[model samples]
Target: MTVCAIEMTTTAPFTIAADGSYAARLAGDGEALYAERWTLAGPEPYAVPLPLAQPEEADTELLPLADGRVLIHRRVAERHAFALLYPTGAAAGPRTGELPLGAVCAEEGGDVRVRLLPPSPDGRDAFALAVTGAGTTVWRVAGGAFGPEQVARIPGRCSGGVWLDRVGRLLALDHELDGTTKAVAVDLGRGGEVSPLLQITEASDDRLLLADPDSGLLLIRSDAPGEPRLGWGVLGSSLPVRFPECLRLGDAHPFAVQPGQALMPETSGVALRLPDGRIGLWRPADRQVFRFGAPAGWLGGTGLWSAQGRLHLPYATPEVPCGIVGMSLPPAPPPPVRLDPAPPTPTRPIPLQQAPL
Candidate 1:
């Protein structure tokens, strides 16, 4: 069995699309960043740029659309700002207008957070998480012709949220209630009823990083191992395996995974930045860690997990502008383990509090 890989050199970082068949890059020079969208279905990847323009600074957050468009978000004062970027090449070079997401969480101040959750499994709409004074709200990003629709909301403080399904029908939110923290599943189509999703034991702190609704596979980060480390478990099949805490030391974010497939042999896992300024990969299933043999002086931050279970990392050396290495992986068989649900351990009685950010 052969797994295809894609590598390219550029000046900007990239985020892969949900299905792993596409990648989007925002190449910036000083004040401006251009978008480069690559189609990966064929042997050769064809790329195109949006109307060259500068929106936010280097820290601009990006979300790739199902139809090959790009979404950009930045915080402007107290409001969450968003703009829908249309690739000019998709319509023969004439760039379409950027759709205004307007101000989300405008009334909420102090790091009003907004995040791009996993897109719909069918490659249709994308979802965004916005924290406002009212509560945590999830908005569906349909397209240019339509405004974002609020599909779900968590009544109280919610953090460490992740999609529980690829179709985005279900979402898991980390909730702190009665002085303890655990994750709860929210049915967007329903009344957002909160149900226990992940809780190893009330004695430990845990949160879901990525979860596959079908396989019940979830990549979790928990303090159960005595320190913050990687833990993975199947919903109802096997016990979770926890890795050493050092695997996540100096890590910028949790491991990457496909929106639906969570773990795959050929896909990339979490990227780690060592104390010596080196980077590495975390394979929880293998219980081993390996660093990328990237070119010297490669900057690291976050990466994308493809549907094929491959991790796509963005790096830049002093000599090269920007590029990506799609770490290849042979198709791995499904994990044989499962986690049996157990009654949650009891925590001291206290007022329900929001999980810390």
Candidate 2:
């Protein structure tokens, strides 16, 4: 389905959990910003306002945890801080206020920038990337034993964070160094040991956008085909990445992939944002893009797919402050059977510029 966009610059994008149970966003009122959490696992999705005593800055980032606490990231001068906000009383009772957690600072400014990664698949721990001129530091911003802790320091300026596994131990990042960019996997469990993940070609800039832990399906964008194109690949497969001609729409990006479809990666639904401010839905097996109009006030490029194939989009209008509209996937047609002899083996993807460190 084609996703539409609205000019809602004041509000921040919703940070949803991997399981689609909860989400957090920064809602603005005139010049002030406040944190809000949405509970989606219940009968009906609803939001809880989480305004602190003072208004939050526009750059503050928020991520919701499965336990119902919202992790907040803010910059105080040069130090980027981390904290958790939760209601003091029980969820059913009146919300006393937000309880701030300890902060993790990464002197951010000038040539350095720090931001939270996507919600961890485990939904218990949270992480952030501190990108500096020399390297990127991955910090456990929340859910650590003692507040925030430095987990790994990866050499090179990295961007784009995707958890390759369910436990969040293996992280895939697009590392740009010496004028080339390629996706590399960081083994957080092993002192952030880095390894090649996506190396389409020596010159190609390969980036991993989204991955499905259940199916090992990876949504990738790379310029290996002379031009940047969206493609799909298996996590550990040796097959050369297949750049589908149907996914060549300029500037389009995939944001969400269907989960719980273990071993059926090709059937999982993929959501992408078209260049002209529309959302595109496609499946690898079908190899065709489905167009649909985006809801008014829909958060562009941010959504969650249910295990049952429902795509839930979070949107907010002036009348309805927080809302989610789900789009049901159209039944896919059967694939054509092959009558000719089996094809030759596909090409193996090229290795990274350097060996794993």
List model 1 lDDT by residue over 102-204, tens digit each. 6565552445567766555656666777775566777775542456777777766678767655565667777766656677777776866667776666666
Q: lDDT for each of the candidates?
A: 0.57, 0.78
In candidate 1, position 250 carries an lDDT of: 46
> Cα RMSD for candidate 2?
5.0
lDDT of 2 at 1: 44
The prediction achieving the highest lDDT against the true structure is: 2
How many clashes in each candidate? Answer: 15, 6
Per-residue C-alpha lDDT of model 2 across residues 186-297, encoded as one tens digit per residue: 8888898888888777888999898887777788888877778788876645445677778989898898998888766678899887777667889888768987777778
